[model samples]
Target: MSQAPASGSIPDSTALETGASEPGARRPYLTRTRMAAVLGALTLVLIVVCAAAVMFGSVPVDFTRAIADRTSPDHAILFAARMPRVLMGAVVGAILAAVGAALQALVRNPLAEGGTLGISSGAAFGAILAIVLTYRFGGGSAIVPAAGFAAALISTLAVYRLGQMHGRVEPFTLLLVGVIFNTFWSALILLINSLVNLYQTRSILFWLVGSLEAPTYGEVAAVSALGAAGFVWLGWHARDMNLLSLGDEPAHDLGVDVDGARRAIFIATSLMIGGAVSVSGMIGFVGLIVPHILRLAFGADHRLLLPASFLGGAAFLVAADLAARVAIAPAEIPVGVITALCGGPFFIYLLRREGHRGIAV
Candidate 1:
């Protein structure tokens, strides 16, 4: 094992991109000031992407014309439908991405993602159950998020416990445990689907794949607030996550209450994941794709990566959702399909890259 860097010493950025024998290994750690600058640039990028996504859907909305004519279809379409969808996409994307970055830190596994922990699957199952119960009995849309959050927290706790090896989480063991949970939860979702009517099946499919079709302002607001809380809560643990990257023993040596911190991180993750999946369905890879890309460019520092991942993820999903809209024209594809298509090969590449040796967190 590589020796832990001494107290207060910055670990070499080398092993990360710090591949030995590569000239690029000498790259400097990303400073907070620089990270602030990057966040500014990322914000700009997000705004531009949002504008583009809003402008170029299946039926283009002319904001100028809509502004001049208040009663135009463009006005309703732009404000009522498209804007909410875009905002929801941004909101959910940010939630998933930011959570993914923090999650990787929690597990000290770079390959760790939202789905890797089974939170997404657990959330999906909860949402599905809510849908089924609503139709069978009688309820409102509110039950869905509640059910999803409950299921996600329970499933995640199960995985956390199952992943432990002698009281500590083994990164690979936790990942496998999550996969098993995902399969179990997914099977339940399928069983429910088989028993449901076609309408419910369509709903189940939406939760299974994912869509940003039409979200209400209320849903958007609720999700945004929850996501913001998750972000700040995780950010509060940034230094601990950084220490954890060094290894469990080293982080403990540095005074991080590893078990306590991990528990808190998992709870926050469950909240956001349940909320995001509740609104957006199983939007697979926003977490995997966004954080990994940002980590590559920004180094694995969660302080920067968390927020940057949020912005970058918002931009990425808005753009992807736009593509899903246009990719078939009039006929839309599930946003998850677009992400899965992109993330599948990316996942394979990551598995292969990290297959030889574990990432240092």
Candidate 2:
């Protein structure tokens, strides 16, 4: 999946520019001024989406009363219910998209994402297993995060290692790895679900479908803190992300700690994925769709792509959640359902487009 671009195309700046020369000046569309403007606009969009998510649920909220008067009934609906869920959605989206952007660069795969690479499946399996264990054993759901993290780390490394041939992640190898890992984890999750009691099965199934329920400030804070940490880690290595696209041998020759950087990045992304799946189930496509769109728009400079993907993803998931809340009125659907509806077609389209462009069959 190393999208090094076919020789015939006037490849985007992503394929052509080395960050070593003139930095942001080489990409006319991705200059420093333009990057800042794009990021600012994305921030504004996220804010607007968040506000809309808060206000436009099935129950009409007295928006001003909720904000100004803590005693009002609307206040509970806004602060105690909607706000935390919306915030959680935003942070989860940010984590996915930011990490996805980094993975695309690291894997040199235009189509790389958490779902496509099996990270989400791994985390979801971990969280699902933890839920089953907690019910069978006496421990609370607090163990979910640790379980999810460990599983996510293992699955991530397994896929990343298998996907890489020599130093590069071959497109065919990555696709096969995704299929194998995803099928394996999903089957295991299903097996666990089949054995559990009705109540436990319901819980496991909810996560499988992906929901943003049990809205609470604690969940928001936990997700935000971890997501922020991962964001910083990826941002710190944005330069290396760029260099890695130049090939591992070339990158190492240019002073990149290839092994160390790859390890750190996988760990950071796995941490974020585990935390998110533990809380929000398997919310799909935020990681895949957001970064792919941003890279296309901003030319794959991880420096610009990461932040833009974060903001765009926040807006996207927030909006998707809002749709999930109201799309069926009073009765809401899973957020994952909405994302899959959007992403499934997008994924097929991307594959078809890639095929037409001469990507390997």
Deviation (Å) of 17 in candidate 2: 14
* Cα distance off (Å), candidate 1, residue 197: 1.4
**C-alpha RMSD of each candidate structure in angstroms:** 4.6, 6.7
Candidate 1: TM-score?
0.90
Q: Write the per-residue lDDT of candidate 2 for residues 25-122, one digit (tens) a residue.
A: 45654577778789999999999999889888969988788889999989988889888989998998898888788877777766777878888889
- Candidate 2: where is the Cα deviation over 4 Å? 1-30, 64-72, 166-168, 358-361
Q: Given candidate 2, what's the lDDT at residue 248? A: 84
Q: How far is candidate 1 from the true structure (C-alpha RMSD, Å)?
A: 4.6
What lDDT tens digits, residue by residue, belong to model 1 across residues 278-301?
998888878888999888877877
Clashing pairs in 1: 14-18
lDDT of each: 0.87, 0.84
